[model samples]
Target chain A: MTKLNKKEKELVHLLKENARLSSEDLGQMVGLPSSKVQSLIQSWQKDGIILKHTTLFNEEKLESTHDTIRALIEVSIRPEKKTGFDAIARRICKHPNVIDHYLISGNYDFLIIVEGKSLQEISSFVSNTLASIENVRSTGTHFILKKYKENGIALGTEEMENRILVSA
Target chain B: MSPGFSHLIETIPSSGIRRFFDLVASSKDVISLGVGEPDFPTPWPAREEAISSIEQGLTSYTSNSGLIECRRAIAAYIEERFGATYGPEKEIIITNGVSEGVDITLRTLLNPGDEVIVPEPNYVCYAPLIQLAGGKVVAIDTSQTGFLPNKQAIKSAITAKTKAIILCSPNNPTGQVIPKKILKDIADLAENHDFWVIADEIYAELSYDEPFVSFAALEGTFPRTILMNGFSKAFAMTGWRLGYLCAPQEFIARALKIHQYSALCAPIMAQYAAIQALQGMKVVQDMRRSYEMRRNLFVGRLNEMGLDTAMPKGAFYCFPSIQKTGLSSEEFALKLLEKARVAVVPGSVFGLGGEGYVRCCYATHIDLLKEALTRISNFLKKR
Candidate 1:
């Protein structure tokens, strides 16, 4: 991987902290004109340095009725000679329930995070769809109990407390 | 009848910096570049330590010289970073803040009628603190030399009654670090004139381009130099009220007596947090990087707006000359706050050499800074 210049590194870190910040604000942060920042961001996007900008949700705030089941599925796959794990990974991600998937390095070839309406629904889908796929070896599924943090944001009631302003 | 206050207390003017801060607080929708503080909160580890210390009931007073472990951490940090050696047992005293450290050092070193040389356009508290210590302040005009005091000025300022000189590196308002050559020359002067050097290094860790040089680290100056530093600027622990003073054994012994009677010691919780801060060097580096980026942005924007500003080598403030706007520093600041809803400190508040400029702190959110700059641009165009 290529190393980012000082300005690029700062821009990336600031965006990671609060991606909702506007180009003007980012420009002010990294010492570029707004128009210049806009162009630089465009170039970064074209170069794939920035894959996406997303929001972090506080799931606890949702009504209990809206709560859903989520699980991490570690898949051991037998890679076909031509396609390796890429084909199987792509096919697995095609499921609407699969929120995120990553190629892995341990006993598992792929680690996938998926969400469903209920435990039974997720189990049925996993057994029927994931296990039935060709060249699939074995899978280990683990349900997520709670999320204390997500996407660099703390997900708890404590974060809502007011902070006292301090001056020097 | 009410007891009367001291004549010195009554005669000394209130801090001009505080006056501007109050004005900012009263106004609505004002974007301020007036505060000399870090925008970042204290690092998580330090805050966590403080919280845990309180949870564990570590709230009582510490030793008069502060917790020995905290002093050891500070000593290790200085030795590792600045190559300065001082015994933690006898050479250091934890202070409420560098503010208290400055006051204590001044009081310990100065006698009635003693004179101390102070550079103008500097941190506002130094001269007043000197006067409060019963010392006369001899002001040196460093504005003509790019805010760095020259050797000749120091020599000229020295007299039989001259006892010490106060120096702030990576200084406030002006943001100039005294160069190593200049520091060596000053050390030479100190030795020749037999005067002490009180170095306020509160912003030492925030230097962008060069490693900070400590006055005490220089040969022959350690004994005469009282080095003051703290967690406020570097670790973003301003509200914690933690700092320290390091000098020769004799000086620290004297200052410790004042500290015992007046302040006793820094808060026990803050001292615990400060220990964590010493271990959390990576966080300080991260904050420093952010401040460096903001400094570049703010100074570049000012220069593009036709304001002549020196690129600050350290700290989060930019001192820009408003002489081009054809207004006095106070006039410029008041008009900007009134018309643009952007608050900045008038440079004259700092001292004699600061009359034509204003101090704008860049330690604010980037969006607010952007808006403030736009408003300032608009206000200037209207003028």
Candidate 2:
């Protein structure tokens, strides 16, 4: 993939800070004219460098994260001869509390993380949902006591860590 | 399966807000500033009405456009609130919340290769839905103008393929309300260019500052505007899955056709309850006042923490710039959650212009907010 050029990179940086930024303010940030900034953004978007604009919510307000417990669930499975694993995965994904789950490699057939109201709820799911599956084996639940970072960014880390860190 | 099922489904990334909450949910003892729903329960009157409807056996489908009473109530409410008028029979169609309203409108309006003008730092749904509809999205970054769209950018982005523009006021992520003058300008452009305006004003009722003006409120502009709103935000009815779309009679007629085949109708019990919600403004007003208090306290603490937070004029979110920390928004969010056990969303999750900022919702309890603030300050100092 082609890296963003100096001006383009600067435009992306400003936009990442506030997607609602005006082209004029964007130009000022990138040292370009408003028209140039607009054109540069248009070009970058056309090339798919800028994927889509969105809103990042304060989920804490939703009380969706109130109990804040992370547990990874592993399910061992043998696919019912007719119905495939994809169908089962989709069924499990439909559960509201299953935030992120993946069909992974190696020993564990599936790696899942869920948010539940309590430890009992998590265990109930493991016992009822996972254990009850026809081709299922026993599962392991790893409760995440801490989350250092995710999506390539570290929270509470110094700003230096966020940079690319080009060596001398 | 649709021909492009994989391609279509893969296009929209999981909401960054949801991702942040995932991290927040991991830490058992964390104080969170990452939620977006109202703190209040669904208004008692509304809940009672829904329960009564169910008790009375009002569970069958009403109509493709939804119950007549609900539509009339919506029309009356909009007229009373913003002087926007619509013929309930022809101009209104209730949907399965604003989420479906947005999804259905984009699906109905855009064609492959069409372009949509979306003001950034707005709602997360607009862009992805536009993409799913096979329309190209042109985002006009609006952070510089106090989170409002620039008229010049709107004009410049217009092309033969421009299908519509989406306006969200008391906007999500950034709580900036669209000024009436600016809205008029946008309406003028839409009129000149012959493109529709899909306005999502779900937070109009919870605005803390000035009164919100509906794009449909402007005379002659109603024909080209589809106003989408819901009871979820204001009434604390997120689980209800009910909303309504008001557009020109012809468009509603068309949208209803698609809606009828798609969702059938908003949940019957929820629709019955929504009717009661509209009839009771006093309850809505009380909730608004409470949100106003939370918004003030949350925004105030963010500013006091030395973060450059924009004082939100409406909604419950405060978009604070964390650039001084020299940390990218994601890094700040992750570290704060892990080290301080306080979770807030990074700005980059919103879009291209969201890098150096983080969004914190004031809808949480005051004690939680204070604790989150303490963790935030400590994290900043250590950095």
| Standalone chain B TM-score for every prediction | 0.99, 0.96
Candidate RMSDs in Å, in order, are 3.7, 22.9
Q: For residues B1-383, could you state the per-residue lDDT of candidate 1 as single tens digits? A: 88888999886898887777777777888887887788777888999999999999999999999999999999999999988898999999999999999999999999999999998888988888999999999999899999999999989999999999999988998989999999999999999889999999999999989999988899889879999999999998887889999999999999999999999989999999999988889989988988887787788778888889999999888899999999999999989999999888999998979999999988887667778889998998999
Over A49-124, each residue of candidate 1 has an lDDT whose tens digit, in order, gives 8899987767777787356889999888999999998888889999998989999897788889999989998998
**Taking the candidates in order, what DockQ does each have?**
0.27, 0.01
Tell me how many residue pairs clash in candidate 1.
Answer: 0
Q: Can you write out model 2's per-residue Cα lDDT over B241-290, one digit (the tens) per residue?
A: 88889988878877887899989988999988888888778878866765
Worst 10 residues of 1 chain B by lDDT: B17-26
Error of 1 at B294 (Å): 0.7
Backbone clashes in each candidate structure, one number apiece? Answer: 0, 33
Per-residue error for B3 in candidate 2, Å, reads 11
